[model samples]
Target: MTPAPIDIPDEIRAQVYVHALAAFPAECCGYLVGARAGVVDAVVACTNAQDQGAHPTHPERGADTGFVIAGAELLAFARAFDGDRPPRVVYHSHTNGRAYFSSVDQDLASGPAYPVQHLVVGVADGRVTEAALFAWSDNAYVEVARWQGPREGGSTA
Candidate 1:
C-alpha cells in the first residue's frame, strides 16, 4: 500500500532546505520529530561531525564530507522527547547534487535503530530540485512519498 503524502509549511520547508544547503561541502544531517497533521512540532538539528567511528571517513576532498549522527546526540534527542512527540522522521541534505537516498543512507537506516521515515533534500545550482521521503520496512528503505515546501532567499527569478 502507498503511504500518505507528507506535507510541510512553505516557510518551514524553505528553512529546512536552506539549512541543508548552507552546510554544503559537508553532509548536513538533522531530525524532525513531531506530531502528525502535516505540521512540524520540533525540528532538531543534529551534528554531522564524525567522531565515534560511526561514519565512513573519506579523504577530505574539499567537496563531499561524510555525514554522521553521533550515538550520544541521538540518545539525547530521544531523551529530550521523552515520548512527547517522538521521532517521526530523520532528515538530511545533499549538497552538490539532488535529494535522493544513496545506498549509504539506506544501509545506515536499515535496522531497528530507527523505525520512522527519512527525508532527503537535494540542492543543486542554487535550486532545490527534489525532496524524497522513505520509510524503513521489511529490511529496506521504501519510497513512501515526496514533498515540496517553499522557495527561499526571495528569488522571484
Candidate 2:
C-alpha cells in the first residue's frame, strides 16, 4: 500500500521558493528539518557543492547547472539534526528546466539510501517556475505531490 502524502506548510513552501529564487544561476540545495509528522518547521540551505565535485555521476552538469549535498556536509547536516529533529525532505532546484527527478537526482538519492521526500524546485530564465515532491517506495521513485509557480511565457501547470 502507498503511504499517505506529506503536507508541507505554506510557510515552508514559500521558503523553498525563496531559496530557489536566491540560488538563481545555480541550483539551490538544502534540507527541511522538523519534529512534527512531516510538517517541516525549518529550512536549511546547504552548499550546492556541485562545483566542489560532490557528485561524480554527472560532471558535465557542474555547479552552475547542478547540485550536490556533498559527503562531509551531508554528515554535518545529519549531525545538525542529531535526534532533535530528523530531516523531513531533501530539496534542490532545477535551474534550467521544469521540476522532475532527473537521473542524477536518482543516483544522488540512491534507492532509499537517502530515504526521505525529495523536492525539486524548477527555475527557468531566473524565475521560480514549479516544484514537485518525489518519494521512494516499492523500489522506485514516484511523485507524491506537486506545486507550480507563475511561469514566464506560459501558464502555471
Candidate 3:
C-alpha cells in the first residue's frame, strides 16, 4: 500500500531552502533523516557531483540543471537505512523557479533505488520560491505537499 506523506518541520524546511539558496544556479541534493516512518527531523546536505563529471550517464550536464549525489555521501545514504534514524525523504533543488519532478528525476527514481520520498525546491534569483514533496503512487511519483515563499527567520518556504 502507498504510505502516508512524510512530515518535514518548518525549521527543517527552512534549512532546505537555505541549502538551495547556497547552491543557487546549481542544483543541490540531500536527504532528510527521521526517527520513525512518516516524519523527518534533520536535513543532511550532500554534494552535487554533477559538475564534477560524476553523473553516470549525463556528465556533460551542469549542476545548474542537474544534480547527482555520489561517492561517500551516496555510501552513507545507503548505510543509513540500517540505522536507528533512517532517511525518509531525499531532496534536491531546481535552478528554475518550478518545483516538479523532471524526467531525469523519474529515471533515477524509477525503482526508487531507496525507500524514501522526494522533495524538490524551486530556487531562482538566489532565493527559494516554492517547493514540493513527492511520493511514489499508482505508477509514478506524485506531489503530496507544497509550500511557497522566500527565506526569512525559519519559515516553510
Which candidate gets the maximum lDDT versus the true structure? 3
lDDT, candidates in the order shown: 0.65, 0.75, 0.82
- The TM-score of candidate 2 is 0.81
- Model 2 lDDT vs. the true structure? 0.75
Q: Considering summed lDDT, which 10 consecutive residues are worst modelled in model 2?
A: 57-66
Off by over 4 Å in 1: 36-38, 51-66, 147-157
TM-score of every model versus the real structure? 0.73, 0.81, 0.85
Candidates in descending lDDT order = 3, 2, 1
Q: Residue by residue across 5-102, what tens digits does model 1's lDDT show? A: 45555566667777776765455678776674456656777877652343335423322334677788877766755676666777887755566667
State which candidate, 2 or 3, has the greater lDDT.
3
The sequence of per-residue lDDT tens digits that candidate 2 reaches over residues 1-157 is 5555567787887898888888666678998888847577889888887755434565335433446777887887767655767787888888665888887777667667654788888877767777899888787668888887765577544
* Model 3 stretches with alpha carbons more than 4 Å out: 1-3, 54-65, 151-157
lDDT of 2 at 139: 72
